[model samples]
Target: VDFPLRGEWIYLRSFGHHPHAYDFVKIGNNRKYYSNGNLLSYIFGRVPANIFYCWSAPVYSPVAGVVIKANDGWPDNKVVNLASTIILWVKATFLFRPAKDGPDLDIRPNAGNYIMIQSESGFIAFMAHMRSGSIKVKTGQQVAEGQAVGEVGNSGNTTMPHLHFNLFDQINDPYQAKVIPFVFRSFERRNGNNWESVQNNTPKIKGEAIRKQL
Candidate 1:
C-alpha cells in the first residue's frame, strides 16, 4: 500500500506485528508542527481544530477498491488541553466502561465519521476520524488507488486531529475481523531537521515525522 496523505506527518499509534487496543492493527497520523517547524504557531489557549496542520487535509484511498461503507455526519470535537485530556482518559477508562466485544455496528460512534473500502485483494481498508461531511465517495462506488476520499479531522474519541488507517478482513463486523499487516511503498522519515527517505518501512513510534514519497 501507499501513503494515504501528502506532506510531513507524525505517526502516533502504529503497530507492525499485532493489533492494538481495538484488536485491529491501526496507524494514527498527525501533523503537529507547521512548515516553519513551529510546534505551536500561536500562544497556548483554546486549541481549535484549525491549529493542527493535519486537520481537514485531503485523505486518499490507499488502494483501488469499492467503497463498502462511507459514514459521516459526526461533529468534530473540541481540542482539549493536557489536563482535560488526562481527565477524559481517566473517566473513559475507569468511570465509563466500553463494550468488551466491541461496539455494535448500528449504534457505535467509536470511529466517528469513517470510510471503509474493500480492495481488489479482498482486504478492507479503513480510514477513520474524518471531517464531518467531507467524504467524497459513496457506498458501492469504485475508487482508484490514491484517489481523494475525505479529509482528516478531530472527530471521535481523539484529543487532537489525526487520521486512523487500518486493514481488516471482515467488512460487516470490523472489530471482530482479523487485522492484516501492511507497509508503505515509499515514504520519508524525520531525521532531526531533515526528512530522510525510507522504503517498505512501518512507522511505529511517536514524534516520528514522515511524508509520502511522491
Candidate 2:
C-alpha cells in the first residue's frame, strides 16, 4: 500500500507516546507554529483551518478496495477561538459513542467524518478527520489504489487539520478491531534542510516531515 497523502514536504508525526503509538496521523502545516517567529500565534491566536497546508490536500487510497463505510457532511470546525476548540475537544473525551456513523454521532463532539475501505485481502483501511462534503466514494463502491478519497480537515478532536489513518482486521467495530501496522515502501524524511531517503520503515517521532519518495 502507498501513503494516503499526495505531495512533498508533508509533516508526519507518529504518536511514539502511549495509546496512539500504532495509529498514523499526518499533520501538515504551511509553516512552523511554535518557534521564535510565531510564538504568539502558537500560544494565543485562533488559527484558521485554511492556515494548515494539509487542510484541503487530497487523501488518496493506499490500496485498491471496496468502501465499506463512508461518513460525511460534518462541517469543518472553524476557528472561533482557541478556547472554544479546546472546549470541544474536552467534551468529546467523555461522551464516547458506538464507533459506527449515526445520528447520535453529534453526542461525541470529536466524532468527525470518516471512511473505511476493505481490501481484497479483507483488511480494513480506515481514515478519519476528512473534510466535510469532500468524500468522493460511497459504501459498496470499489476503488483503485491512488484514487482520491477525500481531503484532510480539522474534524473530530483534532485541534488542527490532519489525517487519522490505520488498518484494522474488522469494520464498524473499533473495540474489537485489531490495528495492523504497515511501513512505507519508499519515502523521504526531513533532516535539517535536506531530505533523507527511508526504505521499508516508518517514522516514529513527532514533527518528522516526510514525503512519498525523494
Candidate 3:
C-alpha cells in the first residue's frame, strides 16, 4: 500500500508489527536545526497549532476504496497544553460519552474529524484528526489510491497537529477492527543530512525521519 502522506515527513511513533498504527508528521527541512522538526518554536507556554510543521498538511488515501465515513465539523484546539490535554481526556471519557452518540457523528473527542474507507480487500483504512472542514469526500463515495482526502490538524485528543493513521480487517465492523500490519511502497530514510532508500517496509525505526520518494 502507499503511504497515506506525500512529501517529507517524520515517522513519529509506531504500534509494532500487528497493525502498524503509525503516527506521522511533516517537518520539512526543520530537522536541520531542531531535532523536533514538527515544532517551529520551543514548546513551553501555549503553542499555537499553526507553528507546527505538520499543521494543515494534506493527507492521502493509501488504497482505492469507497468512503465509509467522513465528517469535518469539529474545530481544532487552537493551542496545545499538557494540563488541558489531560483534562480533556477525562472529560471526553467521563463526561462526553454519556452526553450523546458521538461515534455516530464521527465527532468523538478522541478523533476530531476522520475518514474510514473500506478497501477492496475488505480492510478498513482509518485516518483521524484531520483539519476542520478539510475533508474532500463523503460517505459512499468511491476514491482512488493516493487521492487527496484531507489535511492534518490539531483536533480530537491530540496534543499537537498530526495524522493518526491505521488499517484493520474490520470489514463491516469498523469499531471492533484491530490494526493489522502493513508496509509502504517506498520512502527515503534520513541519515543526518543525507537520505537512504528504503522500500516495502514497516515504519518501525524510532527517532527516524522519512519522506516519500520523489
**Candidate 3: tens digits of C-alpha lDDT, residues 27-133:** 54645422233333434456677777778888889889999889688889888766666666576555554224544533447778999888989888989889998
Model 3 poorest ten-residue lDDT run: 33-42
Q: Rate the local accuracy (lDDT) of all candidates.
A: 0.69, 0.68, 0.75
For model 1, residues 61-164, the per-residue Cα lDDT tens digits are 98998998898888887654555556544554445433543344632245668898999999888888788889999999999999999998866665567787
Candidate 2: C-alpha lDDT:
0.68
Better of 1 and 2 by TM-score: 2
Work out how many backbone clashes candidate 2 has: 0
* Model 3 alpha-carbon drift over 4 Å, by segment: 14-19, 28-44, 88-107
Root-mean-square deviation (CA) per prediction = 5.4, 3.9, 3.7
TM-score, every prediction: 0.77, 0.79, 0.83
State which candidate, 2 or 3, has the greater lDDT. 3
Worst-scoring 10-residue span by lDDT in model 1: 20-29
**Model 1 TM-score relative to the real fold:** 0.77
Q: Which runs in model 1 stand beyond 4 Å of their true positions?
A: 14-45, 87-104
Which sequence of candidate numbers ranks them by TM-score, best first? Answer: 3, 2, 1
